[model samples]
Target chain A: MLSESDLGALAITLKLALLTTLILLLLGTPLAWWMARSRWRFKFLLEAVVALPLVLPPTVLGFYLLVALGPHGPVGGLMESLGGRSLAFTFTGLVIGSVFYSMPFVVQPLQNAFTAVGRRPLEVAATLRASPLDRFFTVAIPLARPGFFTAAVLGFAHTVGEFGVVLMIGGNIPGETQVVSIAIYDHVEGLEYVHAHWLSGGLLLMSFLMLIAVYALNRRFSVVQP
Target chain B: MTIEARFRIDRDDFSLDVDLSVPSRGITALFGPSGCGKTTLLRAIAGLEYHHDGFLKVGDRTWQDSDCFVPPYRRPLGYVFQEASLFAHLTVRRNLEYGIKRVPAAERKVSLQQAIELLGIGHLLERRPARLSGGERQRVAIARSLAVSPRLLLMDEPLAALDVNRKQEILPYIESLHNDLDIPVIYVSHSPDEVARLADHLVLLEAGRVTASGAISDMLTRLDLPLAHGSDAEALIEATVAGHDEAYHLTHLDFTGGRFTVVRKELPVGSAVRLRVAARDVSLTLEWQSGTSILNIFPAIVDEVIADGEARMTVRLMVGGVPMLARITRKSASVLGLKAGKLVYAQAKSVALLS
Candidate 1:
């Protein structure tokens, strides 16, 4: 069983993951759609930038983000001028890190799904008197449903398991930024093997079940649609 | 009224340039071989191909000009692609209603019920497009287009993607549209048979240019065109049911040329029909023979004789002002002394009823 402080860390992790997933969904949909449809040659540059966190070392990204959000950095300086404190050690700082860390997981599936929808249905809708915005809502969004599911599941799951980036940015502050992974790290470092086992086992079981559900639903969607 | 268009498209390997004035009623078929820009012309008319310098005016509405351009969603036109392209997520009924819901109430001319009955697709309303056969999907597509109540209809080789059986299944529905609706239709086709059966006006395209434009019958038989010189060359004759001899199962058809006795059909008197007489099936005789197996003969005057091949000659004849073609050998022509202004008997071996 997790101690009271361990339970607090778990709750903070869940809240952070949930907030990050929602923000990523809101920001990624249009960017993924544009990436799928644009013919410009420079589009690959943006795609590479988005996919950087996938191949990047978590500590390196964490280091860069810490600088960018610190008091002397450009973003933190702008926030300070706008009547806000430096975001380096806040819950909002952890969410911003988690969003960057899990972005590729949310956006790649959506881009592939939008590309699969093709241009024919949109052209047909236009001939049927549907405006551009109308076609996006009525045709494009409905057709890309499976992609949304995959993106949400992957985004949420990836954020829940974040470790190194959160450590570098929001370092082990109980009830504020200390998540389950960091809490388990503290348990094992302090020679509490039983507590570490409980937290790690629960994390493993939850991740596996979420993955199984996503795979099952993905197969069902393909069978029903194709 | 007419649909007038002028388009110039420049591409890397191909280009299209044409000016057209087609009738604003019935069907006008754009007939050409593949890669001859027939589909490009249709797309331009529908406002789908925007990367072109073009002018289009249908009836009194100017869809595109030098200073103005209307997007596809705002144009009052229905376009049917070669593929049916039905929405995979929607039921057939929902697909048909998609276009109907977009048109304003005052502009709604065609009812959903009328469209459904015209295409005979009521049984398919609840089914998704994935479950439909090719013919049924295309019928539903046509009905969906009609439900929009477009001012003009554009079809880009709608049957090109179907097999022969499927094409046969959908042709009657397409034929009925001209009679049931007053909308003008621009149809693109590579098959001559489809153009013959459906077109009121024929526009022949070749290498991105209009080679000939006129009535279907005139275009089919004009000596200057390649249509009359092919082995399947035939002349179209308009006839009406005159009388029926039920005792012998024979039907008499009246045309400007003469009376034709054919196998009896299930048609009422005075009903109009089209007849196709192949040039190879007609033989010229200097005099009518009473004792013969051939039952149909007409007295015609030879108008012109042109060499068809090395050994064959095609004789054009005027039978009461209706033109008919007879292909015979040059030796036979010379032996019979067939010439212009000479009176001859045209024995028709067989005539096919088109509709």
Candidate 2:
């Protein structure tokens, strides 16, 4: 009993999730690597800020993001001055909000993986004549492969399930910014039980399968130390 | 050629202050007990440990000074850590080639094939480090270090982590490295047996300080040092294989001082060998004793005699030019009137041939 509009929402949700995961990975890798290896006294403060979304209610994050990305806000004013439109209530706004909501999901595993790779291997690389940058790429990245896999799956899945953040920052708009979660909410609000049942059940199966794949793949990819 | 290192490192629990000038050839051992700063010194030389106000010069190149410091990767040196920390992800061949591929082709002193052949790791090239036994892994580690063709090699207790059997298996490879390569090596070891067999020059460290440094034979027999006072007190001598006595199943080795007929060895004639004669195994005699059970009897001139205890004393003697030590009861020393420049004969119970 799902309409064509509902299918459009599901496709947008998948698009947003995939794009956000990719962006988060690109921006978060160096940040997480620094947090894992730096000896600076104030590094913990940055760590706490990255971890805020994990404990903060998603609605609060969404509200703050909404205000900052609106027409009157700093970012929105800058966009207008540059002859562009405000990001609020746009697909881009939803991705930005989802990335924030899922920041910890991508960074925590990466930080743990980088830290677990201790300094000894890097020292060995130095003695073997590997430059610092070469060591990071050839040694650290390969050793932290499991963390990359976990972060990718978790960021994508968590972004797909986002409701509060998306609803606040990206107001529901058919075929534009309406994701599957918001579509299900709209169906329930309109008292259309049959349509809501199909969408909700589909999301349930999708989320469960995504989680199963993450766990199964992680267990298989983890390095077995002698 | 020479290597000069002057450094002072201040740690929370310990401090290392060393200034040394060593020849840039052969194996020079940094010998001391654990926690004696031997490894700290080696790390500083390799540019791995940055001590403030450090100065290092290898040949004419200044590796580290007040205004400039060369990082480990840029410095042409190979360091073997106490553990054979081979790259776990790479196969043995890849690990060996890791350093070889980094240096410019013109600067590559040792080829991949040469390193593999030197360490005898040709058969294990395809194996992963995890699958290797301890001895095999250490050999691969050594081969990997040599692949870079470093100007200087620093080995920090390379055999400390191996079992006795494994140590025996790896010692020959290390000896061959000393004999075959022209690269200068700085080896750190606390085991006297290792120093006795491998080190040509000795740098004795105590409490983060260099106590003594010189040729191995002189360092081992210096009575002023604690090395000569232990239960294992012995003297090292350089000897050449003269010939084999097939009838008696003995090998006659000639040194500057005298000739020693040792139990038959497999070494070919004319090969240089080292021998260690323990003080306890040498007995002093004022005259040549005929019909004695001992086979090693050499004419010696008493060099020095020191009272060790109320009833015991130690006598140092020079048999030809090689130094020999004897621990005699004070009664025997007084009866023989042993003194410097006194002529005597030394009867050795046994001699250990070390090559």
Candidate 3:
């Protein structure tokens, strides 16, 4: 009795998670690197800002993102003027919201990883004639591999399980923006226990499997290093 | 060829101001106590630290000058940090090749095989740095640096993190590097023994200033420098193995001034060696003693007798044009009427053979 709408929601959820993870990686890498290395007087200010999403209620973040991506908001107005539509109630809007929702999950791990790498290996690379970019790729990135793994897994899992931000921004549009979490919620509201069981159980199993993979791989990596 | 550097770096607590020019073919040690800015000076020379007014010219090329500075990667130099700091992600072979592959083919002077063999790290090539012993990691680090075929090599207390056994194990490779490689080295160290054994030139740093800079021999025996006043005060003499005395199980060595017979060594004849004659080990005699147990004796002319605080006098002597130090009580100096140009005999209790 599953409808096309349910399958579309599942696909949208996967796409949102993948896109959010990608965007978080691209935007979070340099930010995390800076957070790891900067000794600036106001460094704590930035750290506090990045960590705000971690402690704040997801609904609070969703409410803000909705406001920011609405027609009157700067981002929405910019997109509107660029010959597009308002980001609110769109798949793109869901991705932007998920990226914000999962920002700390990706960045904190990467930042800690980069910081744990210390300055010695980088100095050694420099003396070995590796340019700054070359050193980052050959030394820092490889040494911080565990951090990347953890970040990616956490970002993906966190985005996949997202509900409040998607509900606030994407408005649960069928075939376009309804994600798996919203689908499960809708099924439960309509008193469809069987559908809710399937979607919620799938998400629970997926998240658990992802976490198990991270812990297992991270343990192996650490043992290899040790 | 010479490496001339004039660096002035101002920090919150300390400032490094040094003007040094060392020959481009020998190991020059930056010797000092902890927090003396020796590492900072070396980092500046390597272009790893830029917060300073620095000028560095190596032979015909200018590495850093006013308004012109080369980054570390472009400066054609290899630097070894205090810790081994090997790339954790790369295996030993990849670490060695990291710089080797970056250099232009024509400029690669040290082959990978040669470097691996030189540092005795051929067996460890397949292993990551995490799996290595402290000594093994340091050796690989050295090999990695050497593979770059740098014009200069900068080592900042490369053995500071090693234990005594590890230091002994790595010292020979470093000595060979000093001997075999044509690249000049600027080595930072606080250990006097390392400076004595490895350095041809010495830059003495104290309180962020160049206290003294010269050939190692002159720097070690200078009555004005702190090196000549400590328990570690010793004279470094360059000598060549002359021959072995089969009957007495002794070895004959020749220096610029005279000859010395010490406990035999296995080195081949004519091989150059360095000897450390500690000031405490040297006994002053006004006349040549015939039957004393002390084997090595040399006729020396007193150059100066410095009053070492309290009742002792540090006697500076010129033995066949080579300076030597003898520590004796002021009473002995007065009784012997020791003065400048007074001829004396120096009987050594022990002489260390350093190579």
Q: Which model scores highest in lDDT?
A: 1
Inter-residue clash pairs, candidate 2: none
Task: Write candidate 1's Cα lDDT for A141-193 as tens digits.
Answer: 88888898899988998998888899988888998999999999999999999
Ranking by TM-score: 3, 2, 1
- After superposition, the stretches of candidate 1 with alpha carbons farther than 4 Å from their true spots are B301-304, B318-321, B336-343
Tens digits of lDDT, candidate 3, B1-355: 8999999988789988889889998899999999999998898898888854889998888988888888887889988888888877778888888899899999999999999999998889899888999999889888888899989999999999999999999999999997788889999999988999999999999999998899998888999998999977899999999999999999999998789899889999999999999998888988899989887899999998898888988988898889889998999989999999899999889999998
* B193-269 per-residue lDDT for model 1 (tens digits): 88878888899999889999988877887788888888988888889999999899999999999988899988899
What lDDT score is found at residue B280 in candidate 2? 81
Going through the candidates in order, their DockQ values are 0.67, 0.62, 0.75
Chain B global fold similarity (TM-score) for predicted model 2 against the true chain B: 0.97
Q: Each model's TM-score?
A: 0.94, 0.95, 0.97
- Model 2 chain B: ten consecutive residues of lowest lDDT: B306-315
- Give lDDT: candidate 2, residue B256: 91
Model 3, A80-158: lDDT tens per residue? 8998888999988988889888999999999999999988888888887789999898888889999999999999999
Clash pairs, candidate 3, are none
Error of 3 at B61 (Å): 2.1
